[model samples]
Target: MDQAPGSPQGPQDAPSLPKCYRHPDRDTGISCTRCERPICTECMISASVGFQCPECVRTGSGTGHAPDANRPRTIAGGSITDDSFLVTKILIGINVAVFVMVLALGERFLAETELIGYAYSPQLSEIVGVAHGQWYRLVTAVFLHQELPHILFNMLGLWFLGRIVEPALGRSRFIAVYLLSGLGGSALAYLLAAPNQPSLGASGAIFGLMGAFAVLARRTNIDMRPVLIILAVSLVLTFTRPDISWEGHIGGLVAGALITLGLVYAPRDRRTLVQLATCAAVLLLILATVVGRTVSLT
Candidate 1:
């Protein structure tokens, strides 16, 4: 089995502003305080601390009884779904399913999915890795976990962080942060770790969430002490713990912070464009890193 893939032995794994709800053609970061939905400056009804959507202003209050067309939105302009944590839950399910498969299918299963720059796979009598054009491994490895504890910790962390981060950033923005963070982690590991060293896990994505949550908390003026303590410990573990991919963790942290910074702080005037540019730039950076590393290894 690919037991400790990213270690000396193992592998581990790890958008846009929204359009204005009423005027979908427009893009704005300023959401209605009452409806919590995106609204253009024209639709903004000045209220305390923030603006209210036209409907909320007309209604005189948010009754939470708006029709489905008037679904509430998140602070980041994502529609507030029935379950704010839907995406988070789905991610956990995916990780768990992949973990179960890894257990059932054994090392070959892991070798096929885990992030490796370039490595030989004995089971298939062939070389396999991102360098070999198996770039999907960069993503698959993130959901692949061979050990129980690894998945457990990651899932728990996802739930804990998702509850807050997902709702605030909205579902689409949340997904963007997560996926880019995971890729950043994988790309960094590919660049820095040994070519043949395989690693896989959700740690990168989780760390990304940690970085994001920190930013969100700060933006909302929530006490930072609690998040800081947790982050401090995680950082300590990333460095001190053996078999943990510190490169992936750090990459994720940086990616998450950068991505979320754009999402939250972007000017309402051009929030969508800025956010799209941020994601594109970060993805290009990661891809460039991977390409350079692959060239050197080959």
Candidate 2:
């Protein structure tokens, strides 16, 4: 029975009991933590850790009140947050922003005619002339898309893949995958491209996402046949499409898959860190070799 508010003794003096969410008559005094509403004995629900009001409990809702519901989830060696969905948005924003910059600065004239010196190159010999000397392009070039359709497709792939991958891998791991894939792609291009030819696109990074997905699917209980089919189709489109870099795509795919494999098979969080370190080490070695060759050629 609920004590009248005016009772001199207060809650301490009354017989404490649970109440239903709807009932104003009988005092059943139990409350649900989730909704913070009252519930009576007949309507009260015992959750994993506590009692919940009928509405919040949803008896047949198939919701097994997980004891860890109130606790945080750490999955794939990273903090799990609802905001993981937003990582895709951020990547979209970056690609769009870079495209806008390309547009604002003017197209062919700014991209091809005006040269940025700090491009990445796989060939040490190319570094001697402005034609291929800008090694920094290896990193920056990945962001440079010459056409709208190019950026559009790349962004689409990133948005789709990132939404799925980021949540599974966490923010840091996703970021690492993107950067390393792009770099690896660029490195491969540098080594393979004709000294004077300039290459740029987010294709490498997007391919990385595909590779990561493949690894993730294989490691987890997911059926990967559909994903594999999609990947194969993407490769076909890549080659048939004019101005696309097949080499970059292949390089990024290999790098992403290898990185993903390491992360998935590793013992624990240590694997995630180890994958990151391996990528870093390989990239550094490539950079050093490229830069050294460039200096010698110059």
Candidate 3:
């Protein structure tokens, strides 16, 4: 099974094999038909001529969608995917994976990731948090969950709400909304919560999905009672529950609603630009606030 580096007589030595562009660890001869990037079997997309990468098939030049009608689209002018729940599933997997990592690595990992403007960590034996320029905590904490019940509740909400929102807004916009909501939640906690008070969870992001679902339900004539009822209950709990980050939850809800409003109401002729601009503006505002808070803390 093994061969010398310069034996000049094995498949492993074949010049045809090249490392996949997306996953560089593996070698693949097959390339994307559209982008011509080296792609492994996992990343290949079957096309009329040859296999293409997922990116090329999704938003880039399509394989054989000559007719506009055949090329179905999402409400936000994105290509409709065959699996509406793929993004949601992926999000859950990521959260679970991170949770497993935290379990394996112990409190050190959790201390490093949990959102805090400035909190001294007993595990780390020093001052740790966003104010010390560990800005990635804002993002990592969104997916980090210390308790089983916390993740299960948020993932359940994500599963139901994501199924509703992702299909309506398309994968790109749905994820954009989801991430923005998470960041909005983190930013608010950083700005308003005690600097030493660390908080972490997907609640901010899930609240965002719920908010987006409500917006889409109204626009598409779906029943809004389910979302409203759940949202009301969740908010009540957020305010009453001990150790909960209320600021993050409220921020995510507001951000999700604002982003979805732009998505579902953009003019058809310029939907893409408006959507991009809207997400960008919200992201900039979030960043500006975070910067201001960081400056204040530091």
Q: Pick the candidate with the highest TM-score.
A: 1
lDDT of model 2 at position 126:
28
Position 222, candidate 3: lDDT: 42
Give residue 281's lDDT in candidate 3 (0 to 100): 91
* Whole-model Cα lDDT of every candidate shown, in order: 0.83, 0.67, 0.83
Please give the range of 10 consecutive residues that has the lowest summed lDDT in model 1.
6-15
Candidate 1 root-mean-square deviation in Å: 14.3
Clashes of each: 17, 20, 0
TM-score each candidate.
0.78, 0.66, 0.77
What is the C-alpha lDDT profile of model 1 across 69-147, one tens digit per residue?
5565555555655577899999999999998899899988988899988888887789999999999999998888988
Residue ranges of candidate 3 with Cα displaced over 4 Å = 1-70
For model 3, residues 24-69, the per-residue Cα lDDT tens digits are 9998877653344688989987542236677766664455555664
Where is model 1 more than 4 Å wrong at Cα?
1-72
What range of 10 consecutive residues in model 2 has the weakest lDDT sum?
A: 122-131
Question: Which one wins by lDDT: 2 or 3?
Answer: 3
